[model samples]
Target: MAFTVKINNLSKELTLFLNWLFSIDIQANMPGKSRTFRCKTVKFWSIWPLPPKVEEVHDVVYLDGIYLARNLCVLICCNDTHVLGWYVCRYEHAKALFNVKTMDQAFIWINELSAWRMTYSDFLREMTVDEFENKCFTHERLLKAESSIWRMIRQQTLFTFLEYIDITVPTTNNRIEGGVNAQLRSMLRAHRGLTLERRLKAVY
Candidate 1:
């Protein structure tokens, strides 16, 4: 059996914070092993002309007898090690960056590159619905507009110029859609006791 920590006046807030950090999952809790948590607690100083001894301070924070366990069934896949797609995207980003001259243009190009990467990352992994809607969707639209401009540039048959630069064909945002489906499944499973705090807590 797993032991539950007591949530009293002093510990109630900390308990809630930890729960938020771990998020939620419905499964059996079995006592595995006990461990201690040690961290440095710090204090702030206002000005430079303060006492040297009191200027910088630190305290030790400790937690004892915490049980930790691993769930064999809750395995998740990671594709970040799959480097070919990312290398291609990076090549394209470098090409775009080289073509742009102004600082503002460079910044926007970088934004699109980052967004493009995020789009692919979400596709390979699972993400929340909000991430799908906000990050992936926004990037897809931007890339579509950019694709048109690139098409016009390529039509000039500047073979030698094109050879020096890399190109990435923009793909559909299907990964973003899949993320939304995963989020929906999470929501449906935890739908019985629907409250604002509970929903937000479960999602975050």
Candidate 2:
């Protein structure tokens, strides 16, 4: 067993703030047997003074649309992985949401489960609606422990992306992601301790 040294409230908050800067996932309830999390938590955001998060690097990029991007949420992917799929995110809400432990696992699992999807534009084909439902349900049941959010995603959004891939449609919704966040930070740099609404509005 391990233990954290006793600290005052302010000290603890500062420790967590440091964790978020380096993309370390910490749980108040669990000690460090893990480096990642099974779900999104409040511990991931930056406090003032720290620079914005540095997103994970990928072979390519994507977005979920303007509103989603502006809200500090975006979906990102690459052709080498999904071949036009939505997978990565700014904060990896997908991984945490899906309860997948790491990018390596996510890539393998997504590719294995979704590989049956057709990849050619000239010959568009789809699993029958009945077949799709059955497969999703089967996978969902099999991987239920993996992530409830992932199961929900499989049942709801998987087929939609599959159809788009079959027709060679690009999966990315073009929009500024980290760039938007950077611009907001720069704009707010000179300001000090503004109210939440005012600060956010400036960010927006």
Candidate 3:
């Protein structure tokens, strides 16, 4: 009986290890059936790798949200090289991570400029050569005039990175958006059989 119990324990450990390998394969963009066949295991087991804790502060951070479902989105935070962390929340709540004061100021500017009753295109058309060349029509000022149209340009941090001429910061979060989030979406698409809980685990 003791020998039989030892064999059962060994089998359980092997199963757990295979499940972890299965998760790794899935994350590496392997399809469900393909990975299961490669691992020589059934597709019932699922495991999620725990991300290492990040304590160091980065010079520049980029934030973007990727929608997993109609109402659910994962807010991804990353620097140029590595993903810092992510928060899963409703699509509307994703804006909570943004600088509230800056957003409020943008809204105020939009309201003030709305009284002009001019379209963004019209404003551009009427710009003088000096105003355009002298940077009087800066993105911040011009974009504020049409906040509804240039929603992202109003963010304070969007161009603040440019102020630090000494540091190298990317103008766009394309790395996270294109590299990380895009891969995640593709992985989810490949593993459509995952339940909601498993999907969340896979995302984590």
Candidate 4:
């Protein structure tokens, strides 16, 4: 048992199989513990296994928009405009977009950036080719920066809060995030020398 203190080391395949087994077990139980699996299953699974696949596809997808908005606020507050000039004259806009006060406002601002009609694409098209070329280095870099979030929004249900007005995400709360961080630290402290692969098994 990789989770047991008696075990000195765990192979990658064992970690993958265990993570998958636990995930399936958790899903089936739905907010409660499932019957503990048998050791015999582990022996059987270890012989021939499905290839381990790690997909971070929708991992913390909403956090992308949150992080981007926070970073924009940081850049706006900075004195050096040369570093982030596109946001230079847009301090108020940036503040409103970041909207730390209200979750709904923050969600709206992120959507505005990648919205169909007033999309980032429209921002590019409005500029003369020469001006666009001039802004290529800085502006294009900024554009490319959030391209992934926009892409994710298109594919995922990032706007679920629209239907459920009462939903509050964890990142917005320092208390919950700190508690999670502290738990992680305690885990690492108690189990010194835990590899990233093993740590990720707990996450999976």
Residue 189 in candidate 4, Cα distance off native in Å = 7.4
Q: Where in model 3 is the C-alpha error above 4 Å?
A: 1-52, 92-168
**Could you tell me the TM-score of candidate 2?**
0.26
Model 2, span 1-204: residue lDDT tens: 999997555555555434433332334333332243212323423332222343555533443322233444323333333323332223443333244445565556576545423343223222334644552233433244345646755675433333333344433333334454344454445443445544543333
True-structure lDDT of candidate 3: 0.61
lDDT of 2 at 87: 26
Among these predictions, the greatest lDDT belongs to 3
TM for every model, in the order presented, reads 0.20, 0.26, 0.47, 0.26
- Model 4 TM-score, all chains together: 0.26
Better of 1 and 3 by lDDT: 3
Question: Which should have the higher lDDT, number 2 or number 4?
Answer: 2
> Which candidate wins on TM-score?
3
Candidate 1 residues 1-204, lDDT tens each?
A: 999997554354344334423444321221221111111101101112221222322221111110111211111111222111100011112246456645466557656856875777655444335734653443564457556655644574322233433544223323322443354345535454435334333332
Ten-residue region with minimum lDDT total, candidate 3:
92-101
Better of 1 and 3 by TM-score: 3
RMSD of every candidate to native, in Å, equals 20.0, 19.0, 15.3, 16.7
| Minimal lDDT window, size 10, model 2 | 120-129
Query: What are the per-residue Cα lDDT tens digits for candidate 3 across 37-75?
Result: 446434334555555688996787777787767888777
